[model samples]
Target: MSRIFKVAVIGGGIGRAHIAEGYSARPDLFEVVVLCDIDPVRLGNVGKQFGIARQVASFDEVLAMPDIDIIDICTPPSLHLEQCLAALAAGKHVVCEKPLVGSLAEVDRLIAAAHGAKGRLMPIFQYRFGNGLQKARHIIQQGLAGKPYLATIETAWNRDAAYYSVPWRGRFATELGGALLGHAIHAHDLLSYLMGPVASVFARTATLVNPIEVEDTATASLEMANGALASLSVTLGSARELSRLRLCFEHVTFQSALEPYAPANDPWHIIPNSKAAATAIDAALADWRFVPSRFAGLFAAMHTALVDGSELPVTLQDARNSLELVTALYHSAEQRLPVDLPLRPDHPAYGSWLPEPFRG
Candidate 1:
């Protein structure tokens, strides 16, 4: 297999960042061949900024391009399912942003479509690629962290009326969900990535920060499948913005940097339970190999997976797991009760998680 894969980016907003990461960071692995968006001015501006000659308004144009090997879907959440299905049908691999789809049924359908496609669907959970998190995972895998005990994840950031001026920002149908789905998703996903699958969740949500229909503040208590306990707090109303994660195990406690956007990158403080544990952690991490964080790292891993016929860096199942937690959280908040894991189709919120009038 060749080392390089051609890519087409849909949606101009976050699509510009994906293009830059592909072309600037790992040129040998990815080529940004096309850019698509409904807005001509924004599309042309992004194309010129990135030196991309092909700028089109229709996604079909991207799907029809024979040389594009992958489609990076940076579009709004409402468009993700249809776009992913179309790309897979066109025999191109896909990389999608978070909150993969609005409902569990969509995830199931996408999983089935992926099974028959020539290429695979990879959900973008780039925060999981950072060296700090990777090092933490390594320590845990080596049994140096010991049995997990507790974790606290906080996503405290500010998003005001101006931030939601964009057409889709504050709505449930267009952006899918609010603070829990869009803003705090990465932090929550990182929580599950480090701790393990969540067995249940009891949550509370509010829209106090903004006039948006969706919740801008939320808190959830989680029970991991392995008997670990965790708490997640999220809001778009913080005076000092930050994303923080603290995982405490039997042997050591891992604390991440307070960087609001790239908390997973570095400067993690790993506190050991005892002197012997500290020595062991130092010995284990001494042999750790670093992977570039965010999009670059995700693309590199995708290249290796494609070439070696191995698993994609982030699988569809991973997306489903994240979405399940999302569904459970919303259910718990809406019903004022704790919800169990493995939410089935028969569940009240399985088909659509949006409440009332927003269930369009």
Candidate 2:
């Protein structure tokens, strides 16, 4: 029998979205028993809205709750590592937001911490749990897509002065990164989610789109582990926001819909190299099942994993890989050279990917 996991959600900002779109979407699997926030106004507002009876402004208080089965850390990027460590130490399952930690060193430490803890950890990359991307993943996994050739992914969205009005939005100390970490992270993660591991990367980034410490405009060229090549483009200056992925393989060419927020929804231009490939593709998806998009889909999968004691929907290593890619990109952009993946501890950006001036 599957049990409803009791949750204590920390942080009121994106925390509300997690409760609304994620936990609320799966009532049978989760129950958000507590809402914790440092801000009393936000805590009261979100708690009243969600009808969560138990509200506290203490992270340690929630960590002490023996009834809480999960600690969903929706706090800012900076607070993630500390909260995650504490939550895991408390023997509660954890769900953390993206760009898991500031640096590869911190990620390694968090990974190590999770290993010794009783509770499991799942990173948020909810974008993967969608129809279009899943179908593409299914086709490729079924060996119908053949060898990967090339891919072009673009994450172009707008973030103006008003958006950066929040004290934490543009600063390196709190937000970690600008568009690359905060905005285009999901799209970039989707790149590895579909295309696989990266071998090396050459990147260039600029802050032209906004007056921010981190880069708002960036481009990267990558060589995949599978011997395929890829190009990644990200910006916060696009007039018409769009996120698109075009992947070419020996047998199939897939192009995702140009929806900035929900590119993986449906209606990908799936082209087969030959009629044989077409028939196989059709046969593969003959009994297609509906997949709930975004957080809804992600939370459902997490339930199954926790209940069945199986692998998580999004693993620690998956988060590590995403961060590693980002680290490499930042290093490449700084050095003006191609940087290889599986970065060693000695890498300059391993400790902190922030620029020298911004490094704390």
Candidate 3:
């Protein structure tokens, strides 16, 4: 097994967070070989701070480097598809941040690139590594949840005008969508991960609290393939930022923390509703093993999948499922009707959703 793989990071802000995690959690596994950003100041600052000798002004430079193994994309959502396609075409694996692209068609193109290049592509849904979320996933897969009945996902984060003042923060073209796309994506991914793929969505959105061109608040009702009903609320005008998920089943109940960004690491309360469920859960936990909270756990898993020929936790199909939900949610909001799952290619809102005129 290789001791360290060369990594190049594009973009500075959130890319720095991923770099910090990579350096802190498993320094022996990854090396920060290159840093790329359009802003030379930010690029030089990060390269010097991390002692990474190679500082490039554009992603193309990083892609040209023969030694680079992975490209960690930290740019805005709008840039993901192009960067990912370039990296994969250059024979480097990709680790792009969530909300991969503004449209499902772009996602399909990236997926095709990965297929042709035979390079790995991982969408950063880092919240999956949290201990709490892992625990809930275990219970559900173990049948302790006994066919989920209902679930609720709530993401209320306060992002005032000052928050959107950042140059690329609040525009339809750059930020992609709005509260649902930017803020609540993680929570929504969590919901889809726990429950199954959604079959339909009915949604309404508003730009009430923020001065951005996008919606700051959205409410959506979901119907899952397994006959489970779910509700989702995403907002950026709350008093504080928090996220929580509640799942009710025939035999047990699972509840996760409301922490922003790290909800997966918190403790989850699993209450068995009956003696049979209690015994089943207890037996499962007796054989359970604990995995440490490493930010590069996803990378590690992907590495293992690459070397050992195992299944990747987040696959292209998984990304498609997440993107499908994003597309469906936006379509529902635009048409003001329940948009069904597996949207066709000709759907008017297939690639984007424009906000309606505010009646208020």
Candidate 4:
């Protein structure tokens, strides 16, 4: 086992969740050496609660600490790139939250920074580490389902007006984008993870459901690399909160719910075209056990990678693929035409995107 490395956590809202996960399970591998937030009160409160010795007002303060090994960014979407780049420049690894950086260009820049520093940068796509999702990945990998034919994702979660009342919650400039950017990112990442790279995308977004500055609902049609088709729907206007992913292949169909972060414990239906595949799937799942939290597991993997020079759980190219989907979605919505993958730097939506009325 390697020595416990020092870590500094940025932001305080959901960043606190990462801190809690870090301090709770992996004290032998990691120690929360510092906590930083723009809000001093929040910094103080989190520091006290987490038994942290150092609380600073800026991420730079945390970065300046010689002992810090990783900078865990739980900050808003808008600030991810800035903090991540700074951390890399200062010779620290980064664990940034989902939607990586706001735009494809920012994602590229962070990737470049990590390359130059020879440091690892991981995006928080925790859903991939969940037991339920992992089981789905296993099913796909083992070819029990044959080649996937279709994927349907439903991210129907409620986010009332009060939820967006906090600063930078629903705005394009800060929160980056809406449900697709914030809430459904995990589902989207999973879709890409399981199905492989999307060849093209067509999407439509609307703000009819919420009064926020960004769209609260969207529907996207995806064509995968292997000719599989996928339909993704994101809505913060759902009357009830539920998340589900259904994948149908030639041999079998698998479906699983949100599973409250413990995907293995969740009930998954694996219906088959024939009974033999069903028997195989049943035997496979019988040995399955739920992993507690996706974030925790991934963090543990990241720790191993940092300490043992192992593989990163989430890679820069993976982040690029996730950002590619977002880039395609925004472009397809803007041009009202299907946009292809491998977006170029010259793409109109590469840097920033805004709807007609909102575009300055």
What digit string (tens of lDDT, one per residue) describes model 1 on residues 155-233? Answer: 9999988989999889887988999999898998898888889999999999999888889999999999999999999
Model 1 segments more than 4 A misplaced:
none
Error of 1 at 2 (Å): 5.1
State the C-alpha lDDT per candidate: 0.89, 0.91, 0.81, 0.80
lDDT of 2 by residue, 1-360 (tens): 569999999888888988999898788889999999989999999999989999999999998888999999988899999999999999999999987889999999999999998899999998887799899999999999999999999998998999888887789899998777887789888888888999999999999988878899999989999999999999999999999999999999999988888888897899999999999999999999988888899999999999889999899999999889888888899889999888999988999988898898
For lDDT, the strongest prediction is: 2
Which pairs clash (backbone N, Cα, C closer than 3 Å) in model 3? 130-264, 243-258
Q: Which ten residues in a row have the lowest lDDT in candidate 4?
A: 258-267
lDDT score for candidate 1 against the true structure: 0.89
* lDDT score, candidate 2: 0.91
**Could you tell which candidate, 2 or 3, scores higher by TM-score?**
2
Ranking by lDDT: 2, 1, 3, 4
Candidate 2 backbone collisions, by pair? none
Error of 3 at 154 (Å): 0.5
